[model samples]
Target: MGEKLIYMDHAATTYVKPQVVEAMLPFFTEKFGNASSIYTIGRESKKAIEESREKVSDAIGAQAREIFFTGSGTEADNWAIKGVAYANKSKGNHIITTNIEHHAVLHTCQYLENDGFEVTYLPVDENGLVTPQQVADAIKPNTILITIMFANNEIGTIQPIAEIGAIAKEKGIYFHTDAVQAIGNIAINVKDMNIDLMSMSAHKFYGPKGVGALYVRKGVKLVSFIHGGAQERGRRASTENIPAIVGFGKAIELATANLDEYNKKIMALRDRTIDEITKKIPFVKLNGHREKRLPGNVNLSFQFIEGESLLLMLDMKGIAASSGSACTSGSLDPSHVLLAIGLPHEIAHGSLRLTFGDENTDEDVNKLLEVLPVIVERLREMSPLYENVKRGNKNV
Candidate 1:
């Protein structure tokens, strides 16, 4: 057995980088002060928070004042959707979003629907790409907000946010994006995209987990999500999590500063892994848009095998990965994203999400390639459907 554990779940969350951890230590101890206080310690804390705000703003090409901190990406998503909807209900009642959004966005939209707000869930193409025309066509006279994710969490498909934003801007509708998975991976300019609001989680990009930010464009009106102290310009209120905020800022700075290099390296490793797995494995289907997907994402389905079984085998081999399967959820329903992309329930049941990250290497890819086919083969041998197919009984 291999002594090292191979972690490839970056999309879920990243481990904190050393520098970011170092940047946070002081605030956690000696410099610990409530940012809302007026004392010298409080001023120091306030300064750190403001500096972090500026760093986050600079990373995304937004003004510092436009950034509001939240507890997590889910909070940011909830806040953005509900905040805009409540604040602008008089303007309109319809909201537009895609079918492949994370549960945060999807559930929030459902909540809004219960509140009598109309929402249009747009469908994606076979490649998991939502077209600009689809978005434009979905817009109604009552449409007040367009919320889309910058990238798909499971499939890693990058949406046409700039185009979507342009469409929303043309119609004078508010455009927001859940960019939690994309902030460190892609270039973002709020003004150029005409995005009214965006949500990002610090943990997704090597920062602390409890701190995130929501970008509300200048002049955009949104109701407060957290109501208490006068922190975060009264948008979100609580004593700021200063250490986590500092860590978040440092993480963003490091990620953006080395973006190009990181992309090149990670993409190379990812592509190598994908190519090797696909070429060597039989009956494998790659999900999502090949060209427009995230650099480190490789989602695939192996026919006639269960994803949970494969995940268990990988775990035994010290490889950490994710699988989307009905059995895993103790439900008969397959992954909504996979099914939406035209995969049959059986195929969707076998889906695996192998996301690469900073620590993955060519050796890790090769190790996965070496072990995965054997596991698939072993699993398939026990699968009745696979056995039937092998005996030339396609109907099974």
Candidate 2:
């Protein structure tokens, strides 16, 4: 082997587990059929879909009838926002969300704003947190929906979802959460949390891409996102993607079954890396809340260093990481999440996100530790900002 690829980008995507692949193989070849058809093969397809639905539902503590499969997490988010916006228009046009939400939620909210809805984008503190009091204060009588992410994709800040859920419930307003990043890494009980709707994706949890699910609680009115076949109970359309759905079911089943053990392993790696990186590097600051964050997330910002340049150097060494969320990585702008957490634009541009996964071992983390300080030192030497600060010419 040339070299193993040390991937620290689990928040972006994950490789399909062998078990998930095996579970999906039969659906693609032997059981190929249109789920809508009533023939023998069709019945098998329908059966698999229903089974997967139950698996996904039970994984998140939702009823089987409430889970609606979508093409991707983005689609699930879009449906949750637009469906509620249109159906509850007569009730209210105001929505509550945070500034650091994934673009899926932010962009959809923007689209709704153009259509005459009002949105309140709450700001986070230095550690990227919005208190339950802030959420309660933001609520208005005309606020129809409150969609906040269960965990942030960039800084891995775990929101007080249960607290906010209670606030929304007390106000009788609908609540939705984009739990895509939190699903496999954290345990969730939607019923206990009082969440009315939630979004999830399989690729974030060692399953195939292009498959996602949205949870809409019973008695909640949501207009159809797609009008076509009777699939997804007419809430969503398009023929079922049986193979991917099977993979999704298997992935969630395995992930949730041993979530605590998985978290222990990855959290060890994450904390060790943080300890080493911060202790060894000067002028490096940790991002997100120290104790109340995801198990496998370590975000940092090195003064005078650019994140994209560091990522390029890391890539050449057979390591994969991220500057921010994969959805907004293409943009030259600094992360909105970083800004919302009180980072200046220049400091935000220097952010580095290293997220862990099941496949990452201690050796991978060690390799990163070995190479990271050298890279940061080399980059800092070339930076005029560092030179000026070194000579006592300027203050940080």
Candidate 3:
């Protein structure tokens, strides 16, 4: 706690930018009227919502009418999967998705399975990449949708989304990508990629939390995930979160406008940190693709130590990171994303996710590198597993 806190968990969420906050202020106070109302203030709020829609659509090359706002990325994901499934039940009853998907998509697929929809869980390669060929092979006549994440949240592996989308297009199946992590970090053209549906979150890119958008291609019929009012063109029913939506739009504008500069700076710092840690540490393995991954993502596993212990030690040093071993179930289950990429339970148990962001710098990386090895060594010294390896007693 003595060290200045270094936040390397941008993948979890990002701090809202000042510009975004400024843009949202009007919606929260002065222009605070329900978009559903017909009064002057309501009309103004409604107009702002539409403008935000257009900005989001233009950023992703989608039609403004096709953008549906939701409370969160998970909501959008559930809507896309279940909406397509229910809407196209007569056409098909099977959906295909990867095992590495976030719990939002994975759990929805599981729920669909219980409701009598067949689901094909595709596997990934050693680098956590799902191949288009595997997706193609998994398709059946009853396959109605394919939902794969654009980039893995934990491992930062970019999937072959374009290839998979093309295959789905050729086969007349809907393709949906949860691009929550990929939206700010990479360029996504829905039309160019032939994606039928895509989901994005605001908080992942310096926007306010609890606001997200789903892109549904024109002419794609889907049942409503939320049924009540005409908001989101009746696709989703809820009063528009005006302030958060405005903030989301501003955040996107800023992120895209400064994408190149941010990429260069963050990538440089991230790579330096990775290089330093790997060069100085023992038996460390880098997870995910080296070159084809996100600019600010660095995931690694240090053998002979538990991920929770490492995370706790890092916390003591005021280095904020995440480990795959921490779970909502309160069980030390290995991250499903890590295991899907072919890591053994022990290796996956030691996984660390260090996602960089705008505020990070070379000095921060140097500080992390300075403290990390000592922490790892201290933990390994108490680890019976490490002692056995050092003594040439290989038995577990």
Candidate 4:
């Protein structure tokens, strides 16, 4: 194994920042009081929760009252889709979304379909983009919601969110985006974008895991998700996870404050890695938009090699990366996002996703470039498909 570890899977989740940890430590022990209580320690906890809410709202151009904390991005997504569906079912039963959304969105939509909701799973172009026109055209009179992801977790393709949001607004439909992968990476204004609902995860942005938030625009009709307490302004119920919430707030504040510098540094490393890998490796295909992708995302497919093999090989070389979303890593199927963008089953099965972050340096990129080509070459040499092609077997 290589002496140093190179972590390049920020799209899955991020390590909690030290500053966020410091802010959260007090809530865990020193101020270990239930936020719902009315006593002194409880009041302090409540105050901390509200302050964190304000920080989250400020980071995303939302009103503090709009942010409701949840257990995870998956929970937020489930709530957003189901809440809007049930609340507005009398008016509409149709929801439109792209085919390449994360399983958090896709599976929720599927579950809604089982509950008698109609969904239009729109297809994306080869570059994994859904146009505003596709959204505008898919709208039916009964279309209650349009839920698309802000950015793809696998291929890292950013959607035309503003345009789609505007179309939904003009059509008088609610819009929701799973911004779990986009919260800290992209600048977003829910009001300006006409987004009625959005979901975010703390772990995606250097905050604690198991805590997330849903932004519900004022006056949007959404039924309560959890039903036990008066917490989250009666929208979501449960005792609040104050420590993680505080960490989330601190992390978002820091991330948005340093967004520009973070992008610049990470993008340089990403581009260099992409350029070097493609230049050095054979039969490589770059996934997602060449330009309109997340700054630190580098997705590629090496022909005649399995993505799992590549990932394991890279791991042995001290590079921690992913074949696709970490949530689906255990699955043997090819990435749905790659297939949505027209990649064949074989090529899609060979996809690799390496997302950069603030801590990744040029040395990390150099090490990857040096080790990756050798790994791919070695893997392909063992591949019968490449051997067949080498022997002029065109049918392969």
Cα-based TM-score, every candidate? 0.97, 0.98, 0.97, 0.98
C-alpha displacement of 50 in model 3, angstroms?
0.9
Model 1 residue 233 lDDT?
Answer: 80
lDDT of 1 by residue, 257-364 (tens): 989899999899878878888899878989999889888888999999888899889999888888742113455467788988999989998988988889899899
For every candidate structure, what is the RMSD over all alpha carbons to the true structure, in angstroms?
1.9, 1.2, 1.6, 1.2
Candidate 1 clashes between residue pairs 3 or more apart in a chain or in different chains:
none
lDDT of 2 by residue, 55-103 (tens): 9999989899999999999999999999999999999999999999999
Q: Backbone clashes in each candidate structure, one number apiece?
A: 0, 0, 0, 0
Model 4, residue 10: distance off in Å is 0.9
By lDDT, the best candidate is 2
Error of 3 at 22 (Å): 0.8
Residue 176 alpha-carbon offset, candidate 3, angstroms: 0.3
Please provide, for model 4 over 1-396, each residue's C-alpha lDDT reduced to its tens digit, 9 standing for 90 to 100: 536888899998889889999999988888999988999999999999999999999988999999999999999999999999999999989999999999989999999999999999999999999999999999999999999999999888899999999999999999999999998999999988999999999999899999999999999999998999899888888999999999999999999998988898988988888888888877899999988899889999889999999999899989999999898999999998999999999999999999998998888888888888889889989988899888995546
lDDT of each: 0.90, 0.94, 0.90, 0.92
Instruction: Residues 135-171, candidate 3: write the lDDT tens digits.
Output: 9999998899999999988888898888988999999
Sliding window of 10 residues with minimal summed lDDT for model 1: 324-333
Between candidates 1 and 4, name the one with more favorable lDDT: 4
